[model samples]
Target: MSYSNAQELLSAIQPASGGTEIFDPATGELVGRVAQNSVADLDAAVSAARTAQPAWDALGHEERNRLLNLAADRIEANAEALAELLSREQGKPLNGPNARFEIGGCAAWLRAATAYEVEPEVVVDDGETYAAKHYRALGVVGAIGPWNWPMMISIWQLAPSLRMGNTVVMKPSEYTPLSVLALGHVLNEVLPADVLQVVAGGREVGEKLSGHPEINKIMFTGSTPTGKAIIRSSADTVKRLTLELGGNDAGIVMEDADPKAIAEDLFWGAFINTGQTCAALKRLYVPESIYTQVCQALTEVAAKMPMGVGLDENNVLGPLQNKAQYNIVADLVQGAVDSGATVLLGANPDSEAAGYFYPTTLVADIDPQNDLVTKEQFGPALPIVKVKNVEEAITHANSLETGLGASVWGSDREQALAVAARIQAGTVWINSHGTIDPRIPFGGAKQSGYGLEFGLDGLKALAQPQLIKG
Candidate 1:
């Protein structure tokens, strides 16, 4: 059923009392409270998942696919309500490529999972012997999601796991529990009891869930440090993990590329979701020959994009999800300013403002070693560094340890493809960045974490490969 407003959806989800209090990042008003689930709560959820998984898996792929498609239909039915709750809780505007886009993405991923073909593959059929590979359910999957794109990313983890015949126990970030809780409420309308569980909790619960012996695999999307921590916790149980961690994505603009032509795309590439996105371009390497032109074009486009509260239909961008994130963006931008970098636009925020609104900032003429360029300042601020040539641009782009995604922009497809090969990111785009497709496989390189998400391979990631030979 559809909800008329955020409150109606919030009431349907039945927010927990005497737990964690959630506030709107755009307005600093009380949104709701969620249960501060304990390690015991995680244990109960996992135990329940274990009890329900066999029956769910016994339903087999055909029935599972049908149920998942039904869940997707439910998501569409409640799309507006879900988007409204998501906008208020996550600080993403209802319009633009924010809340509504995310809601649509959730359904799209689910439908993609249903459309994917998964069956036993024949590896050999020689005269004397036969062999085939088959993928089986991995029991229970623990999906821990981050605040940014919480609902969509949770579905990215959940849909595949369920499609592969595994029950899911999800732990949403404490920052935006209501959004996930509300979304899960919608999905559970079609999902069988105990097949999917959303346990709203804190670090202890996450720690317990990661190390939980019953959890066969953990699908996590969040920070690098937290990913590392998950690695450590899972070591004891030897639990399989698909970690999509932090990214300091970089973008290169060729000297021959027209700045004005790519301005709007470049603007959204860096500032979409107010740049809180992990794959959003955080660093820009431009040829010095056209550095001024590129900066001016970006500034002109950035000036046109409106930023305000989430419910405002006119606004394309909104405030930071929380104060700590706002401060990190502020500190990184301040560090760049102290290094004598020129502020092309923004970087100034009123401390007295009610919400965590950091202006859409662009820094030019910044050193390659500056914190804003080297660190993952996941916010609306982008540091544009000028390079003498393409070689230097590629060098600076590949310098970071984290490489989730990167892009090379040029009119020449061959030249852009050549440059794209040198980057260390999992997905490298030519003339575009941060755009993802459900059919395409996505993962990371180096310390950006490992294992793939989306597409057929994503389904495989959540399943165990078994070989049948005779």
Candidate 2:
């Protein structure tokens, strides 16, 4: 899929923006170029949205449901191509799996949101009914998504906002903007262009869109520091905000744990997406009894994963999106080594041929207060801290500034659930890591960011109630 001609690339994109550069993670090749939105492009999109919105919104729930559902159908049709393109741009191992997960999950959200009952019922006082309640949309929602899972996150934003009757202007991360832009073109075919619009470019473009006065709300997913900055920027306008930030989630392994199974769970959970997830199980606390066995089992599993291009079926991991992440992961690994933490397996990634890849590293015996354990290292490096008992594991796991998600691994489900209950996070998985659901709400606790993205909880976030006197 080479775009030798500029016009061919131009036609592929719906609302093209300049300064967009595409790189093949496999060969580090220049795969494509994109023209980002100039001020004129932004004007056109916003005006088009402003024009199309009132009518789209006026059509009300039934029409909106039909249009959004059609958009979901279109997403299904393009699933394969989108997956391959997403892998080429962002470099996740399960290009096929990830793509399928995102598409299916997005459709589910649209379907769920369609059934959202925003009508008012009865909540009375004294002798007679004082007022009635109803929910209203928040106008245009400014959704800014991350590169790790752009398509899904965009749907995370779009599903709720559209259901609530607000129009959307989504700005995807510059590193992986193509799939999102392509979505805009697809939706235009199924639904009106105003319902879902994808606006792409670099940080400057994002800042402009996020700060636009017309935008009533902003939903973002990224690092805590960046989330704070975005909140501050949106503060002047006092935009409605939902920030999904960072996490150094802790996984607790009890003495009663089965070392072999726990080992496999720990590696995949903490190190999935090369350890790039915000809620990915990160710091691990293991009881002394099973420490040696757990370590040995994990070392072998980590060794089996091979890093290469995402398109390769057998590739276990792919490259980091860019050099900055590569350096970040590199330094974290080096720091752990200097802090008396032992690197049990693998080293800094050596990807001389293609993509920014990092080998999975399991570091043990580090002080719990060490930056490697406390800081949010979003990469394929797992650092383990030994704890005397489950109590200490619970305390240490909750010690971080961010609380996104965690896992409690043990043979005893009751014990794991009890320990998981003690850890402070939005979601805690027992005997597993990194499982998310559209029916169940997903978000973070504390600095991990606030607000839910899916399920009935998400519908509430997008809805507002109005009371009328009876």
Over 4 Å off, model 1: none
Q: Count the backbone clashes (under 3 Å) in each candidate.
A: 0, 8
lDDT of each: 0.93, 0.77
Candidate 1 — what's its lDDT? 0.93
Model 1 lDDT tens row, 1-470: 76777788888766445767799999988888777778888899999999999999999999999999999998898888889889899999999999999999999999999887898999999889899999999999999999999999999999999999999999999999999998888899889999999999888899999999999999999999999999999998899999999999999999889999988888898988999998999899999999999999999999989999999999989999988999899999999999899998999998898899999999998999999999999899999999999999999998989999999988998999999999999999888889999999999999999999999999999999999999
Regions of model 2 farther than 4 Å from truth: 1-11, 14-19, 94-97, 125-127
- Model 2 lDDT tens row, 291-356: 888888999888887777777787767777777887888888888888778889876566465567
Q: Highest lDDT, which number?
A: 1
